[model samples]
Target chain A: MRTALCSLLDIEHPIVGFTPSEHVAAAISRAGGLGVLGCVRFNDPAELDEALTWLDGNTDGRPYGVDVVMPTRVPTEGTAADLDKLIPAGHRDFVESTLTKLGVPPLPDDDSPARDGVLGWLHSVARSHVEVALAHRPRLIANALGPPPPDVIEQAHAHGLVVAALAGRAAHARAQVASGVDLVVAQGYEAGGHTGEIASMVLVPEVVDEVGGSVPVLAAGGIGCGRQIAAALALGAAGVWMGSCWLTTEEYVIGTAMPALREALLAAGSSDTVRSRIYSGKPARLLRNRWTGAWEESGAPAPLPMPLQNLLVSEAHRRLMESGDPSVVPMPVGQIVGRMNDVRPVADVMATLVAEAGETLKRLGELHP
Target chain B: MRTALCSLLDIEHPIVGFTPSEHVAAAISRAGGLGVLGCVRFNDPAELDEALTWLDGNTDGRPYGVDVVMPTRVPTEGTAADLDKLIPAGHRDFVESTLTKLGVPPLPDDDSPARDGVLGWLHSVARSHVEVALAHRPRLIANALGPPPPDVIEQAHAHGLVVAALAGRAAHARAQVASGVDLVVAQGYEAGGHTGEIASMVLVPEVVDEVGGSVPVLAAGGIGCGRQIAAALALGAAGVWMGSCWLTTEEYVIGTAMPALREALLAAGSSDTVRSRIYSGKPARLLRNRWTGAWEESGAPAPLPMPLQNLLVSEAHRRLMESGDPSVVPMPVGQIVGRMNDVRPVADVMATLVAEAGETLKRLGELHP
Candidate 1:
């Protein structure tokens, strides 16, 4: 398990867990792997600071990373209110009608502050996140969508943090290397959230070839078990950056959505998911449910561009989550969900991956002998 | 290269090449690998018999195979003539208008018979092909689209030929195993021709797990070079089955279409391909040329169902190939086109894959040491 990536990140194994939960992140780091907390959900700088401070105290001096969503080109050019106005009326009508058709109940009439600002898809908000993340003692900072801006990469380097970018294509990996990234996370189309059409088997080696000897490459997408970890290393990746596998970890607390998500993932076959723009205005893999089916059905309106699409669906997602309907809840997961059948502790998951990978490596060595 | 699959197939290497040309197939077989001749184009039983006879004499006693496109579910339930009539007028009009709009000149009217019957999308024609192939001495028989019918599998076994099926999903692989397929080719979305949405990294292990020692699995899709082969074996595949890499081999003679096809492949990046139903009615990954782009552009008609779509585009494909126009040529390729930068002999390709995979395995071994 201790490869070059392990030495580079000072971890016992070359596995990095990406999660939104502080508990899972701290547990993975304490279990001898780097735990990267996804910070795109943290809109307020003070809240992000508090979360990092808590992680520092909980991890017992182990190193962890932070992941932010910062696209090189923001879809809309305006303030939050102005961007909200750019969403098409047809899309809103479709969302509302589909939810009504799905028999989703309306939210209770209570005065809660609008949670729109907390959804971070804007460049300004992500930049603020980078500012807060750099203020903390993290070993790595990764941008999920595209190459981090040059000044941000420079600033992160200046703060002695490794700058990482996720790319779904070889050309994008080259661009990230040119922009001075310390690591490139080559994700495949089967990955959850935003991904390009290239799969992990193709993208990893292409990105490794494109970057040449400049920076280490981390394989992402469709990586859950130990055999996949071994495959990633054989594809010339320095490590594996996994996110979907962590969703079912015992420490992953998604409030009311946990039970339904776990059940959906357990019941899902490999083909049970689809890549659609209904969730984020970009083609992201999500478990196929009534919500995704409604958007893809005939006569459904085309999803709007990002940020606007994210904003339009945010309310619907909230209502669905509150409704506790597993059939309609928005679950972003990778194709590897087919393998995530059980809810295990973070330490157990790490041990299984390491042990299985060790066994796979030994078996492969016997092939030549 | 001497894995269980190599011994099972009696090949020196575990590499299998799928090509439409009998010359390339014989060359690959002579190169100590299994060469499978794609027989979908040989709709006439006599023509297929002639081709297999040619392959037998040319391969120098090396064992070769035959691949047929026998989709488990026929899209249309009718005789060949009835299915031909089922093609809509709108699809024909769209194809003609698009080809004319692209300035492709009409074919010269020589008294050559309308060779349209040569295309085998109908179950009857594919069954005829299987009958013709079984009359020969092929070591293996493979179904490209789905599991071969149980009778077909039984007949192949009766003839002492190995039965293999290509699966894009784990469930499909399990179905094939249940149908008594001897080998499962777990193809990913990045594979050329018809493929499902699951990528190889996730699909291979899932398929392997599903079969659970019932049959060996061959990793397909995005496999071009040696490192990818190593990655496939690491993912627990017994061998590597490749199609797109052979399209650029020096012996691949598509007449005048070869130069333009090779140029397009060399210039393509990994993201330049899209999975579309324009070519074969099923979503197959193809190079993004003007032909594919026109079908997907705004105001374009949705592609018709399988045999209908294949019928509508057959004439257009013939004209494009005859015209030698690279921009509008219909080329079925995979994302691995990014790595097919040169046209080498079949022997050299095998040698490179073996050498590169050997080095990769050694490097992986050193990681543990």
Candidate 2:
């Protein structure tokens, strides 16, 4: 399973597991693959610092990375309070009404402030994430949207951290390389979260053709099993950058925080996902649930732009997660959902992926040996 | 580059070249790959019979296949004239107005009747295609939509011809195998013609897992180069079924029927395509042009059902073909259009695909060996 990426990233296998859970991140790195913790969910820098400290202690000296959501097309940046004002009343009403229709119960009123979802998406907060990540022993920092800002890239390099960017097209990959990123993750349309129109079959080779010698390219989107990993490598990707596959892992967000979401994901087929802007004002592949379906219905208010859209529906998303209704939450997942039918530990998943990929590569090699 | 598909199809490489042009098909078969000629373009049985007869003599005794567009959900079965009446006047007006806006002039008045595009999409006409194909020496008969209705399968089998069907999902492939088709073409969303939501990265492996040992799966969609062919085989497909790559071949249409279309295609990138229902009643990927863009605009009339949509726009399509305005024609193409930058002979394309696939497989085999 080793490739040029294994050498570059100093991992045993050429796999980068992406998850928001610190537990999963540590497990993946400990299992000899790079685990990238998604930092966008942590609106507070203190929380991210705490999570990184925990990852540092648990990964047994293995290398790991962190991912942040910094929009290439910079969105309106401000405090969450200032950003919330930009959301329209109609959009908020649609969310509330759609939640009522979906039978999602409201959260119990508490003195603790509601979780702010849009802050981390803004440029300022993402820079803070870069700062917090730099203070840790993380080996890499990845941007989910596109290339990180020039200053951010410079800062990461100064801290001896490798900068990686996600690109959906060859042109984007070239631009990311030109902007001084160390590597490119060619995330395709079938990938969960933010994605571009090209599929992995086309995007990976195109990106590799554009930047393979200059920088290693990791194939993302719709990659789960070992065969997919082999296919990605065969398409010229140095390694595989996987996210959706880890959502169902035992360490994913742990406990009851997203049991309903996991159940819905387990029951989904390959065609059960939809690419829409309803997730964060940017088009992302999400599980097709009532929450996503309602916004697509005729007469439904069009989703607002990023930051504002996430702000408007943050409470609705929270309530849906807590509602215990599997059919209502719009969780990000790839078309690989069809194969994720059971819960497994991160080590077991990594073991199976490495074993299968080795066997597949050996089998394919025999074809022309 | 050989696989089980080569043995089954009696070709040197596990590649299926699908083209609507008989010249391209014959050249492919002569070059040691299976060339499957698309039969849906020929509405009349006599014309198809004539073309297949020419193919029989030109292939140097090599085997080829024929593809027909038989909709699983049966459409209206009637004469072209009878079916034309069912198209809404508003839809006709929209097509005419769109043509005028695109600077597509009407064809010169001729004594011959107008070409009817929807007839071949109907059940009766496709069945006629099967009849004409069976009369020829084609080794395989493929249905584009789903499994040829059971009788069609039985008819092809009775004639000693293998039957193959295209599927976009695992379940669709299972159904095709259950319906007794010998092979399944797992076409993905990145493909040129009518496609489902799943992409080749996910769809190919899913289909192979569902029906691989039972029957070989031919991976299609976004497959243009030998590297993609290698990746498809790595993903468990027995072969690669290609369509868009042939559009830019020297023998694509012959003469000057589509010089402008070829130029536009050569200038296209991977992201320069959109999946829309404007081509047929079903969603198909088309080169992004002013014509497709116009239909996507607000207030544009919703495209009619399959047969009706084709009937309403058949004349417009013909006029656009003759108009020499490349930006107006909604040509079916995949994201692989990015790589099709030059026109070459079909033999050169076949040789490159075979050579590249062999090198790629050899390179991947070296990773572990």
Q: Distance (Å) between predicted and true CA of B254, model 1? A: 2.7
lDDT of 2 by residue, A31-94 (tens): 9999999999888899999999999999999999999988888999888788888888887788
Where model 1 places Cα greater than 4 Å from the true spot, the runs are A77-79, A115-118, B75-82, B115-118
Summarize candidate 2's per-residue lDDT along B254-356 as a digit string, tens digits: 4354878987899999999999988788898999989889999887998878887887777777777777877876699999999999999999998998888
TM-score for each prediction? Answer: 0.97, 0.99
Q: How accurate is candidate 2 locally (lDDT)?
A: 0.89
> Each model: TM-score of chain B?
0.96, 0.98
- Chain B TM-score (model 1 vs. true structure): 0.96
Show where candidate 2 strays beyond 4 Å. Answer: none
Task: Estimate every model's Cα lDDT from 0 to 1.
Answer: 0.85, 0.89
Docking class of 1: medium
True contacts kept of 1: 0.67
